[model samples]
Target: MLPTLRSLMRQRELALHLLTPEDALPAGALDAAIEWVHSSDLDDPTPFLSAGQVLLSTGTQFEAAPGAESVFAYVQRLRDVGVAGLGFGTEVVRAGTPDALLDACLQIGLPLFEVPYRTPFIAVARAASDMAAEERFARRSWSLGAQRAIAIAALRPDGLSASLEELSRQLGHWVALFNANGALDRVFPAGALAASQPAGPAAAAGADGLVDTVRREATRLLRRGQRASSTITAGGETLTLQTLGRREQLRGVLALGGSSELDQAGNEVVTAVIALAGLALEQNHSLDRARGQIRAAVLRALRHGDLALATSVSDGLWGELPAEPVRCAVVETRGGQLDAVTEHLEALVVEHPGRLFFAVDDGRLVLCLGEDGLPLLTELCSAFALRAGLSEPGAYSDLDRAMAQAEQALARAGDAVGVSEFGEIARDGVLSYLTTTDAGAIGRSVLQPLSEHDAAQHSELLRTLRLWLEQNGQLDATAQLLGVHRHTVRARIAQIEKLLGRDLSGFQERAELWAALLVAAE
Candidate 1:
């Protein structure tokens, strides 16, 4: 800190005397910061000085302007220019300090001190300059020390968390870290206002409001899908938010909050932390990708009937494969929503490590979760508006067959936004096996003649055939459902049989056509 007016007067070597009475002192008058000291004899010296400076001058200016009003105007000009105080050199061009100057300063509330003959103006300026220089040195040293501590913190086992805590301690403020999903990953200084209740009622309310605002802002930044920083003021504190990772793929957000603004050194420390945190996130991202690749490899092995190999590879990392009689779920979402869904599932994998194991195959999210986790999978599919298929419980050795069942169910799921369980459709026995075969494609080829005839003649033969098959060849039921007469349904059915060259009298042909429609709906 720089020397104040009160401190200058306390220096014995300077021997400065306060001309203004203590009772007449203005607010913050005694502790006025003195950045520099200047001596000028001109009547107007305001142009040469800056704010937070002390002016030193002989009584020559007072000699020119001898009246009390003139002296008052001079003090007003110095005050207007934010001069910390005025120092009048006595015993030079005058016997003592002028009465008009003393009265003007006392009335205007501008601090005035008498400089004794023994103390040179140079000494006062040098003293203030030295104090300023020492402050700069102290701040720079602190910055270097803080940077060193942060760097050391970054080498710890939990480097990211440790470094953030160190940064918060050094800054004497709260720091929060969020993951790519905008979920709060960590917060420094445990039991902070953001993490725990405050002591006072007013503070408690303020803390709650601040936490909500911070979360909303963090989410908004990630949703913007850009690399940026924001400064916000809430609950009487300033908060700084910065996005980590690249603009194209944001990893997370880092937030720092405090009651005061950061100085130059504090800003430098923050910059260092951001760089370190960004590098850490990038490293973690690479590790996550490697783990995903390993998971995919394991899933491939399981599908290839290499359960032992899969178990050996994934046992330590992700816990045992969801045990025998595991159910497989295949989930898929819109193209733009893949990242959001992936982040949610990744978080779940971390939370429920042993109970669930999932891997992305092609564009779909495939999972081999325990029977107990089926309900959670169903909820996830509904929550994310994802199209999913669940296979019947099967042994780990039969994972290949189970995956085929899930794909067949998924294909039959069509464009609907929900889960399709293979068990629901598998009760038809032979139909289940037939649905998975290329028979659906062959049936579609067989029905092409009917589709073209209907499109050309704008007839209802295909619709009549589907309804007839659905109603089990009940003429009255199909006709009533179609809002047509039984005779018209009979005529359309006859035309359908002739066009497709398939005898609808048999259940095999009708089931094949129905299966074809189901597969093609996807």
Candidate 2:
């Protein structure tokens, strides 16, 4: 096992004294053996530690009394400062050491290590340095062992999950595989890592998002779906991430819990791990493709004749091919910021695997099938828009639908448009009616009059006409919709027909007028 706080302490021969109110600061508190002193004075002191430097200090700079009157405030202050540990340093600060300080340290739950005045601070510092060196050596050896393990994993006849679990154990970390959408599919951790994490599929959100971001970038680097990797933070964890290739792509993110610091060496190891993941993913994809091909062939044959193969497609990397019902919802970006849109989709998928989601051709978003209700698509659109920092979600359905809706909603929502859940916009007017009609050109022509009018006055005539038309020529309904009497509806209709020089009773004529009314509303 890699060296830990317990092991390092043992090797250093540092007096093992449990911190308690009864405990006194051992004679080593002021010794130069201690490599560094931590003030725990607001913000962080990690910058001062360089690398491998042991830090010592008294807890006074961090906490105060631990009673109800001052407990939370005292602990909060110390946590905010982020001290290594408090060392009384003999006569420097507090006479010997305050019981309150030790109590506070225990209550705050920060790691507290005792220092003895007899032990020279320099010797302590040296011990820390030596321990760090030893750790580095051990890390290198483990990395080499991991390299060898990867080689062995490459040859494993087991499934991807099994091989990866062993690899994670060798690396002493938790490894997770994310899909293009950022959903957690597989997780392999060493020993207690899985138990420490919420890995049993209770809605993978935080970890899923981290893996998704990394996988997406990795995919861009190695399009083969078999070569990709990225690193990101999610759930307050430092994740050294990477991805696999396009064929058998694995959007995997690896995280080791001991240290938050990331070095060039760690990055190299992460890169190598990613390279190995790429190989595995490529192999997985090829195997999947072969399996998919055979299944598809049989399904197609069955479809033509009789056997019933499930209509739904697997969430495989082959684009929900030949089976699943995939719809392309185009999300428009500013100039060329498609990657942001992809990120939004990824954020959504970790919670709801509603669809096989992907960004297509940069300007558009595509979704596979939804596991929940059809309305989830609407909610998802709302969420994606909101996360993208948009305010009100507009009619974001397909590329044509969402783009058009977003364009219109964006005007009012401004940046808030995408942020709002557009599916709940209460769209029950001309806009809603127009959604069903592909009446693109004629509708615009009908609304041109209103555009000409908006340039002049914000008149009620056009508005009344739009309301009446949306009510489907029903005088009573139009009256209700427009908050006017039934007679007002008839009168407005007469004026509108006379103004346009056409009777609006026939279906064709009604369609044209309705289109025009919609144009004006927009």
Q: Per-residue lDDT for 252 in model 2?
A: 39
Q: List the residue pairs that clash in candidate 1.
A: none
**lDDT at 518, model 2:** 54
- Cα-based lDDT for every prediction: 0.83, 0.49
Worst 10 residues of 1 by lDDT: 190-199
* Candidate 2 residue-wise lDDT, 1-522, digit = tens: 222334435654666344543224323322212333333333344545432233465435534533543544554454454433343443344455555555565666544556666655556556656665766787787677766666666666654555567656665566666544443455676333335446656545544554555455444544444543345564455565554544453443333332254544455555666677666666655664465455444334333533233223433333332222323233445432343344444445554554434334333333333333234445655654432212132222232444444334433344442333244344555455454445556666765655565557765666676666677678898778778889877876786677677787878887777665554344
Which sections of candidate 2 miss by over 4 Å? 1-158, 176-185, 190-276, 291-433, 436-441, 447-498, 504-515, 518-522
Leading candidate by TM-score? 1
Q: What is the TM-score of each candidate against the true structure?
A: 0.67, 0.39
Per-residue lDDT tens digits of candidate 1, residues 189-218?
875755443557677677778878888899
Candidate 2 at 482: error in angstroms? 9.6
